[model samples]
Target chain A: MFGRIFHLLVKEFLQMKRDKSARFRLLVPPVIQMLLFGYAATFEVFNVSTAILDLDRSQESRALTDAFVHSSRFRIAVPAASERDVRDAVERSDVQVGIVIPAGFAELLKKGRTSPVQALVDGTNSNTALIALGYVGQIAGSFGQDYARNLAERTGRALGRPMVSVGLEERYWYNPNLNSRWFFVPGVIGTLALITIVNLTAFAIVREREVGTLEQILVTPLRPVEFIIGKTLPFFLIGLLEVSIVAGFGMAWFHVPFRGNPLVLLLGTCLFLLAALAIGLLISTVCTTQQQAFSSNFFVLNPMFILSGFSFPIPSMPQALQWLTYADPLRYYLVIIRATFLKGVGLDALWPQMLALAAIALGLLTVAVLRFRKSLD
Target chain B: MAGAIVEATGLSKRFGAVMAVDGLSFAVQPGEIFGLVGPDGAGKTTTMRMLAGVMRSDDGSITVDGIDVRAHPEQAKRHVSYMPQRFGLYEDLTVEENIRFYADLFEVPRRLWEERAAAMLTASNMTPFRKRLAGQLSGGMKQKLGLTCSLVHTPRVLLLDEPTTGVDPLSRREFWQILYSLRGEGVAMVISTAYLDEAERCDRLALLHDGRMVHCDTPAGLKAKMPGAMIEVAAAEPRRVRDAVQKLPGVAGVLLIGIGAHIHVDDAGRRLPEIAAALSAAGIATTEIGEVAPSIEDLFVALLENERNAA
Candidate 1:
């Protein structure tokens, strides 16, 4: 059995090596995609175009507008003379945000009363809008705190008692700077590995069936289990190699840290590869043609990708969908990989995810093996 | 029957509403080449697939080399090498690589395959092309490579389904030479072919029609059993000759061949002069008219026609 599987692996690799498209697919696309996703699949908002309408022509209003200009997050691309201009800027998407300083005229600050600043936002792309709003809130919040502190210091000198003020201190864990690259680079490893392994595994078998080699092999003395092992083992190794390439590129190019033990990541990868290869094998058994396999890959991988929490947070998904994510190997793999890359956690901390991944992998492999019959039904 | 290497009894396979192979019974002896001759969709492939143990028979049983195919198909597969109509050779791999892969699949030892591969390649005149990728080889060479791959392990029973259907005549003859050599070594072979000329080369032939075996015999026996004599009429337009004589009395059928027509009649001597006279009167010119030995196709058509008339 070992000898047969070894020969099968050799044959598979030879075929892969000789076929130009397969060679290209095995190496080039993952790196290109890693670079693309590293930059494109990001949540960190920066240089958000802003329109400023200062109705209050006072020192305090100008200071607030200056604060927006100074901050790296917002760029004062449009300076509005009136509310209509701000509205037009936001409505036409000329600016992602519009800041209107109402006609309070520094009186509220002098009297120690609260002032309301209206932030007009374009909510078409809700995620960008929400993040931009957060930046706006932070800038306005710091300005308010500075003003309150000045007022407290002046009032305390007159009253002979210090005023108490509340302040919030925010610190992000794992990702010290909350760099989105650190978060997304690890997810890119999982996503790219999944797509590459699944496609290679599925196409490997579908190509055989289409070419009629599968029927020829079945008549040989080679057992079904042996053939299955032979056919899938090379792909399993390819999956591992692909993960390493993508992971290594992520670390070197994006500087995505790998904090966990290497052994733990290897184990997690093996389990993940098992699940992915099984899914591909299952698709191959169901499909009689490569075109069917291609379409089926989309049908299967798209849902798994969405539910894997790679880009979208699983908890934020619909309740049923969140439950559905429990069955996706990518979901558990993403957790384990992200934890390893960013948190530097090992088996003890990620045991639950590791176990879930192992269970899903074994379950899928069992089903795939059972579904893959030596006989043509 | 005692030493029959492959025995299939009352085998039946159904596909939805179609009985692809119904009540098929045959035995193949060692060193014999058995042919399944039929038109398209005649269950020859279905029968071969069943005997190879790659497909399950809905009824009956097949025993290949003392192993019950249904009971232990994997075990039965050990002794059988099935080559489908489209012999699946990995096109990207070279000729020697393809053979080595199959040898490994059949668990043939390295030393044994090294020798076997060399011999098989030489036999097919593919020794020089061993390094050439299978896809780059001609269609005929691809079929030879497929055969070489299938024979790497020296299987006891070889099941080939229309192996030479699309091959050139020269290649087809070379392929038969390979089969005859294998037969010399006592390999029981079951080969299916649509070409009747190829069928004539087999030791025995089973004529399949509508998923049933209507006749089984040697080529000479089958032609000798033909009820009517066949007369060949060499004409400029065989189609017109066929149309002119098709409805004549005592005429069973008229098959149009290249540059001539084979007229199946009750008695060739009696009908020959009459056919010639009728054609001359119909303003059709005939170059020659005489009795000719009936081919497997003639016997097959006559048999089917008899059954149709009886039904």
Candidate 2:
């Protein structure tokens, strides 16, 4: 059995090695995809172009404008003389946000009256625009509060404060800064590895069926268990190599933190890969043609990605869908990976997720091997 | 021999209600090529799959090298190399790589693989293209590469399922040369082929139809058992001649071969005269009529017709 399995592993490895194009397919593309997805796939909007319409042209209005300019979230583009300029700048895509400080003449501050300021924002890309608009509200509100406090102090008037203002202290559990890149980069690594490895193995077996080499392999002294293990070992190693490369890029280039123990990450990655390869093997067992295998893999993979909590948080999904996430190996691995990297948590805190991943890996592999063996029979 | 190298007793398999190999039984000698010759859906592949231990038989038993294949499939597989109709060559891998892969899977020792691989490549004339990927090779080269991969382990028996189906005539001949060479090495071979001419190359041929082994004998012996003499009839319109000849008194079977018709009859000495008269009566010109040796295909058709008529 050992001999048979060793033979298969060696064969798989040689196939990967002999085809330089395949090797490049297995190695380079994942890194490239990691970088592309790392930089391009982000939710946080920065450097949002904002046009300022200074209708007041007064000292107080200029000071308000200066505060908006210094905010990191907004990049002040054009100093608009009229409201039409602000609309033109926004319509032409010169600015994603517009700030309008009405002519107050500094009298509203003197009378302790709340003045309204209109902030126009482009809503074409709604998410980014909404985030930008929120920043505008925050800056204006803080500036008004500070200005009122100063006036009260200068006049020596007693300040009346409401005790019912709720200050909710919320902390991000896994990701402190809410850095989407840290989440997406690891998810991208998992996704890319899953896709490439599963596809390669699926086609690997289907190619055998199509070309008639499968019969040749079947006639050998190799046991079904041996064959399954041998076929998946090389792909398992390839997945590991890919994870390291992507993880390296994530850490060095993207400055994504890797706070978890490397060993645990490697172990989790290996289990995930085994589960992926098993799924590929199972696909191969059912499909006779390469085209069929490819289409079926896509059919399974697309759903796995959506349900895996790679794009959306599993916890935020509906109860039923969230429960389904337990079946998804990616969800567990992604959680463990994120927790380890960003939060720097270990197995002590992540044991349940780690155990779930291990269970999925073992279950998938066992079913795959059994099915393959049954097919041979 | 005391015992056949490979034996199947009442081996049966079914897909739904259609019996693919119904109570099929056969045995191959230790060092002979046993050919299973039949039409496309004659259960040839199903039988081969069962024998190779890649598929389970619904009933009966298969013994390969003294081990029950059904009970000990892996053990049986140790002594056999099965080349399915498709011949699963890894197209992405090179000729040498494919061979090496199979050799390793079969656990051929490192030293033996180097020597056997070199010889197998040379025999298939695939040495020149050893570095080329299997996908890059032509149909003929790919078949040869597939054969080489199967033979890397040097099994006692080789089960080939239509290894030369889509290959060119020249490549087909080359493939047979390799098989014949293996025969010299005392390897028992069970080959299933659609081409009757290829069946003639085997030591013995089994005529299979609807999952049953109708007849098994040497190619010449099977042809000798053909009910009557076969005559090739040439006419301006062969189809008209075929129709007319079929209605004739002694005409047994009429088959279209190329532009002419091969007419089978009970007794060629008396039947030819009757066939010619019938053709003339039907206004179909008979340019040529003479007795010719029956091919394996003619014998197969005759057997299938006999079975159908009996049913």
Candidate 3:
């Protein structure tokens, strides 16, 4: 059985190597996506366009405007004299955020009285808008404090250094800069591997049936388990190659930190791939042609991608869907990859997910192998 | 010289409302080439599948080389090799690679395959094209490669389903030559084909029609069982003469052969003159009429007529 499986694996590898375009597709997509989404797929708001409405052309308002312009996070895209103009700019998406200073804004601050500055923001994309809102709040709160301190210095009032104060000193572990790229790159490694390995293995067995080669293989003494191994081992190695290249690219080009052990990463990746390949093999067993296999792959990958928590958080999903994610190998692998890629955690921190992924893989592969063997009979 | 390599008795199968194969029984001796002759939908494939142990028979006993296929299929499969009409060849894999895969599947050692594959490739005239992808090969070469793949382990019994259906004439000849060589190697073979000429090459064949055996005999034996002598009437207006001749007293059947009609009579020596006179009376003048040896085609046409008339 071992000898036959070895032979089958050799033939599978030879075929994979010969189909140049297929080979290119298998290895290239993960790396390209790692680079593309590494830079392009980001949630960290930078260089946000801000529209300013300066109804009061005073030093207080001008200083606030200067602060918005000076900060790297906010760039003043437009300066308007009227509130309507600021609203229009935001509505037209010309600016991601808008700030409005009222007519008596400086008088109220000098009297140490209540003053409100209106902030307008585009909320179409909630994440970017939320991040922009945070930057704006920080800038405006500091300006208010400075205004209060300046007024007290001139008037020599008792209100000095403000009465009430709450300080927030936030520290982001692993990614100190809170770079979204670091978070996304590892997820891409898992997601890309899932999509490619599933597609290739899903369509492969059906294509054999279509081309009339599988019937030949079935007649041989090679057991169904051996046949599955022969087919899976080559693609499993390909998936590993893809993960290493993408993970390495993410670290080298995108500069996502890799604080975890390579061995743990590989083990998690292999376990994940085994389940993915089994899903593909199960799909092939159910489908008769390549078209059916492809559509089935699409149906499978879409749900797996959604539930895996690759892009979406499992906890944020509905209670039912969150429960459903436990069955998805990608969900566990996403956690494993993120920990390995960014958090710099070891097996102690990740073994639960690794064990879960292994259990899922064994369950799926058991079903796939049984279905395959039954189909042959 | 050797006990039967295969013994199939009372095999039966049904697919929904259709009885695909009914009560098929045959025994093949060592080194014998047995052909199952049939047209489309003739249960040839269904029987082959049962013998290959991929499809189960509803009721039957099949033993390949003394192992019961029904009782223990996997063990039986060790000694049998089946090549379906679409003898599944991996189109993307090269010819040599495909062969290597089968060799591995059967666990033919690396050293043995290297030497055996060289000989097989040369016999199939595929030595120069071993590196070509199976999809790129001509239909005949692909079939030959499929056969070679099945033969890698030197199976005791080889079952091929319509091995030459789409092959060119020359390649068909080359393929048969290889099969003949395997027979020399003492492989019991069962082949199915619609072509009567290919049937003639088999030592014995079973004619399957409508899920039942219509005739089972050697090619000549079946022709000899033709209820009457066949009178080949060479002439124009063959169909016109067929209508007139079929109505004659001793005429059993008539099959159109090009511009002629082969009319089977209870006794052609006595019926030839009557057939000639009848054609003349009907004003459908025949050029010449004489008794001729019946072929497999004749046997099929006669057997079909016999079944329909009985029904």
TM-score: which candidate is best? Answer: 1
The residue-by-residue lDDT of candidate 1 on B169-256, one tens digit each, is 9989999999999999999999998888888899999999889998998999888889979999999999889888999998999888
Taking chain A of model 3 alone, its TM-score versus the true chain A equals 0.92
Candidate 2 residue-wise lDDT, A49-138, digit = tens = 989887777777777888888878888888788999999999999999988888874667567777778888899988898888888888
lDDT of 3 by residue, B111-225 (tens): 9988989999998889999888888988888888988889888899999999898989999998989889889989999999878899999999899988899888888888877
Query: Which wins on DockQ, candidate 2 or candidate 3?
Result: 2
Best by DockQ: 1
Q: What DockQ, on C-alphas, does every prediction get?
A: 0.71, 0.64, 0.58
lDDT of 3 at A343: 77
For residues B1-311, could you state the per-residue lDDT of candidate 2 as single tens digits? 35689989999998998999999888898789999988878899999989888899999999988899999987788788888767777777777777877777777788998898898788778788878888899888888887887878788889999888889999998998898888998899999987878888899998888898889989888888889889889877888888887877778889988768999899999987888788788888777888999987788888888888998
Judged by DockQ cut-offs, is candidate 3 incorrect, acceptable, medium or high? medium
Maximum-lDDT candidate: 1
User: Which wins on TM-score, candidate 1 or candidate 2?
Assistant: 1
Q: Report the CA-based lDDT of candidate 3 relative to the real structure.
A: 0.86
CA lDDT, every prediction? 0.88, 0.83, 0.86
| Superposition error at B34 for model 3 (Å) | 1.8
Order of quality (TM-score):
1, 2, 3
Between candidates 1 and 3, the lDDT winner? 1
Per candidate, chain B TM-score? 0.98, 0.96, 0.95
